[model samples]
Target chain A: MGRTSDAKERILSAAQALIELRGYSALGVAEICKAAGVPKGSFYYFFNSKEDLALAVIDEHWAGQRGNWQRILGDDDPPLQRLRRLFEATEADQRAGQQSCGTVSGCLFGNLTLEMSNQTEALRERLQQIFEAQVDMVEEVVAAARERGEVTVADTREAARSVVAQLEGQVLFAKLYNNTRRLDALWTNCLALLGAASPGRAQEAPVAPAR
Target chain B: MGRTSDAKERILSAAQALIELRGYSALGVAEICKAAGVPKGSFYYFFNSKEDLALAVIDEHWAGQRGNWQRILGDDDPPLQRLRRLFEATEADQRAGQQSCGTVSGCLFGNLTLEMSNQTEALRERLQQIFEAQVDMVEEVVAAARERGEVTVADTREAARSVVAQLEGQVLFAKLYNNTRRLDALWTNCLALLGAASPGRAQEAPVAPAR
Candidate 1:
């Protein structure tokens, strides 16, 4: 049982890494298996198909990141500050990814959605559920900020969607340009969208993750 | 010569359609040829390779859309109104696309960038050039708006890039949701970003193209 679980974890990690780097359709099961150091039979035994593995990848990836998100957005700081910290953390992640891979991979959900939304109904629905959940989290943050008068917006839901879209879009730009500065620009714009005063460039460093 | 040009046009159109609907890496030369009803030999005769054909598709697709952008952004209307008209036209185009294909196919440049930027350097550079050109046009409009005291922004270039990013990002959402209403929300948020007043939802129709 221990050995079997180890192989499953390896396959999930390998799929997440490769999918993040290349995309959904570009990478094959063979490459994923090779990267995971697992046999083909084990792959099928663990997951029914590549699509099933992708779904697991999404869930597993989000599961690992959800804690970071909850900690960042659920901080005791002012809502606006918490939002800034969340983006700062994102910038740090992108920078780390660039240093490791020579390219920023952007959001896995966004990448898969762009590549496979129209091609695969099951994958698209799964991604939509994940994004909707993320957007809800953003909405909650924005709503709290609005209640406290830290943020001003006519519609909190729309504002949240805009914030999420801006983040995804800027990440896409960073990946395309292979530069992290685009993320800083995105942060600045995000500040403006939230009706918060620009704190200048002094806040580019990633805040330490909450304990 | 006429027959040769006809075949070339057909191939370019088909490639654009397939690439926009799917993505760069997911579609192939043979599939494009089959869609265009052009023989494989004719496809090669018209373009050197699939990459060359992709470049041509970008060029041709932009050629078809540039006139609309110029007409909308270059109109005699106020800068804010012109910008609104530009977005409204974009929404109309997205709506039409959704109606025709039952899905929102986001911006071709953005879709390609996300899919192929890391894998294909030539294609990435070509896309960068095209995006830069588009950004230049946006900067011109934004600079003009700033000069006229219509749109107040700290930096014209950043504002223009933000606008482009927002447009690309929202289209991505529209594509992901398979819905056109996201475009409306994007326009509303864009107004907020530009510090323009919400002219409300009455202006959903495509503004008349400049004569």
Candidate 2:
């Protein structure tokens, strides 16, 4: 890649890490620049403003996710299994140090929305577009799930929406509680909502199960 | 109350609104002072730091949630019914024009854990305690569901945990998607999970007239 492209990628990656690490709100432009090993000029050289940088960071962040997310959501398995695999992959990322946990992303996007939703129609539209894209992506999987007979749910669309909500809530809890176990449980419930039980879902005797 | 005390309340309320409406990140002390109609010197006189003010904001926000939430979660009704009511309340809040839906609290508590979980040990412990407290609160009702035969699930504790994950997930989805509809579906599915199926639930659907 060209030097300019490398600098841009460096800035974006730094933003992702810090945003994931310290959050967009907590971390300042100086910190981002320090993390990226780039000068302030390079930062503003590429992005017009802090909000612009944040927007770019969000764009770059999700743009990177689309392909990985699609791969898992669009794998060779049945739609339901593909969905589970996608979550399992997410769980793996959470475990293997891929923070950002879209669940926690509300702090930035929703935070920005609160600050600018009134003043910046452009940002609001951008946020809406990103989220709609997510819902649509999920809707595609739910439609596939219906075709696959994996779930006899009454409404695939609503089910898809709930799955998104469920996944997002789990991320927040995981962050709050600093435990990934909820991720497992939430993913299991996702499958359950789609008519598939989580692995080892049945509760044993409240006492001990005799081996 | 003294004028200083009144200023504190104004600062707290202003901070709460701004944190929920704007964000906790660098919402300048000046902006808050302006919003609260308090003098800058008076603001500094009340709180030690912006974060100190933020903690107070969270406390106040939590207090505001108490009456409404207690009514929904701790009512003189079935645990399942109470649960559904809580979800319905979220729907009402969103439709009523408050953009700051608790669906995604941007959960100040959770957000702190995410940003500071790495740097500060005391904050880490505090965040864990908060989550445990909330989880315990929810588990109380989940335990009732177990005793009353409302929930046919095997393990009430696990069932309760599963429910919490869904609730948190719905919050994130609501905010990320900027809509409360998913929160509504989350309530419906949660009710179903607890075995309180209505006309919407598949199992509760009346048998088709002998076609």
Candidate 3:
């Protein structure tokens, strides 16, 4: 059972990486199995089809992301400060991806939504649910900020949606230009969207990681 | 020669439609030819490869969009009003797409950028160039608005980028949810981003088309 679980984990990780780098349509189950070094039998044992594996991958990916959001947005810092830290962490992750992959891959959910939303109803429905959950998380943070007087928003739900959209849009540009600098404006713009004060140029700079 | 040109036009139109619905990676040359009702031999006669055809499709699609933006954003209205009209036109188009296709397909450029930016450098470069031109158009409108004191923005270039990102991001949500109503807040948010006044909700609603 332990070995069985390990095989399943390997398949999911490999699928996520390939899908992130290339996209959902450009990959196939055979390639996924090859990348995972799992035999055909194990692949079938783990997933019924490519679509099934993709669904699992989406769930797994969101679970990890949900944890990250909870940690950053649910932190003990001021609500606005937590918002700032959330975007800073995103930029850091994209930079790390660029260093490893030679290009920044944008959000997997956004990528899949663009590629598969019209092609597969099942995938689209799953992606929509994931996005709604994400938006809910952002709305919670925005509501908290509003209650704390950290920002003034007429509608927290719309503000939260805008935050997700802005982040995804900027990340799309980063990938399109193959330049991480495109993301430098995200933190400031996010605050501006929330009617918060500018964090000052010095603090807006992407923090260099300690070696 | 006329017949040959007709076949080429058909191929490009078919490719664009299929790609917009399904995405760039899922459709193939054979499928594009079939949808166009052109033979495989004729497909190669007009374009060298799928990549070549895709380039032509991107150029053709952008040419049409460039015309729309110029007419709407370049009209003889106040700069701010022109900006509002531009987004209003976008909402109208997306709504039309929903009525026809039963789903809202977001910006083709943005959708392709998410899918192909990492896999193909040539396509990425083309998309980046097209986006730069689009941004330049927005910057010109923004600079004009600034000169007229229609709005105050610290950086016109960044402001234009934000507009594009925000619009693309919202359209992405519309596509993801298959809900055109997700776009209801675009014009208002756009005005807010520009530091301009809301046009009031009644006017903000997409203007009904004249018969």
Candidate 4:
């Protein structure tokens, strides 16, 4: 049982790394199994198909990412500051990815959305749920900030969407140019989108993440 | 000569359609050739390899899109209004795509940026140049707006990048949700990002294009 479960974990890890490196469509189960150092039978024993494997990968990635997001957004710092820390963490994450991979792999969800959304209804639905959840998390922070009068927006939901959209867009550019510095504008852009009082570069000093 | 050129155009159209429907990686030369209704010999005569075909497709799409952008951005309207029209056109284009294809196909360049950028240097450079051109055109309008004191952005280039980033990001959402209405927030978001004085949803009433 231990060995069997270990094979599943290895396959998942290898699949995730390959997906981040290339993308979903170009990947094959045989290649994934080869990379995972498992046999072909192990793949079918675990995943019914490549799409099923992709769904698993998406769920696993979101589980970890959601945890990070919940921690950052649910922290005790000022609401706006928490949002800022979220952007900083995102940039840091991309930078770390670039350092290890020699290129920005970008948001796996965004990459999969562009590559696979139109081809599979299942993927489309899964990606939609993930993005909706992301926006929901951001909206919570925006709502809190609005309550404290840190930002001025009539629709916290739309404001959150714009902020999240900006992050995805800048990350897209970062991946395209292989330059993570492109994301440095996220905090200032976020403040501007929310109509924060100090929506100037002068106010965009990076803050240490609390916890 | 005319027949040969016609075959090349056919291949490009089919490849673009397939790329939009699926993506570059999952596609094969024979599949593209079959969809194009062209002989394999014709495909080889016109393009060197799959990557070459992709580059040609990128160039052809950019050629057409650049013309539209120049016409919209270089029009004799208020700079901000031109920007607004660009957003409207983008939304309308997505809507049109959804009507015909039953899904929002999204910006072809953006779709490729997320899919192919990390895998191919040629594609990465081409996409980077395309985005840089987009930013340049937007920066021109933004600089004009700044000169007229209509927008209050200190760095026109960075501001333009942010605007384009917002665009790509929102388009990412629009594609993922398969809803073009997701883009209606673009003009308002743009106004906010540029720090325009009247940045409110009430001010986002759609305006007809000035040709």
TM-score of each candidate structure, all chains considered together? 0.90, 0.81, 0.92, 0.94
Task: Please write out the lDDT profile of model 4 over residues B60-127, one tens digit for every residue.
Answer: 99999999999999999999999999999999999999999999989999999999999999999999
**Colliding residue pairs in candidate 1:** none
Candidate 4 residue spans exceeding 4 A from truth: A199-211, B199-211
Over 4 Å off in model 1, which ranges? A197-211, B197-211
What would the per-residue lDDT of candidate 3 be over residues A1-211, giving only the tens digit for each residue? 6888889999999999999999988898889989998898999997899999999999999998889998998888888778778888888888898999999998899999899887798999898888788778888887887787665566777778888888888889988987777777776666656654333321122111111
RMSD of each: 5.6, 5.3, 4.7, 4.2
lDDT measured at residue B96 in model 2 versus the true structure, 0 to 100: 57
Tens-digit per-residue lDDT, B19-126, candidate 2: 655555658999999999999998888788786676666566656666677767787898877777777776666555344443333345544554455444555555
lDDT of 1 by residue, B107-206 (tens): 8888888888877888879878877777777778877876875555656676677778888888888888888777776545554455442233211211
True contacts kept of 1: 0.34
Instruction: Give the better candidate number (2 or 3) by TM-score.
Output: 3
Worst 10 residues of 1 chain A by lDDT: A202-211
What level of docking quality does candidate 4 show? Answer: acceptable
Chain A vs. true chain A, TM-score per candidate? Answer: 0.90, 0.78, 0.89, 0.93
Error of 4 at A112 (Å): 0.5
What lDDT is reached at residue B146 by model 2? 70
Minimal lDDT window, size 10, model 2 chain B: B202-211
lDDT of prediction 2: 0.61
| lDDT comparison, 1 vs 4, better candidate | 4
Residue A66 error, candidate 2, Å: 1.5
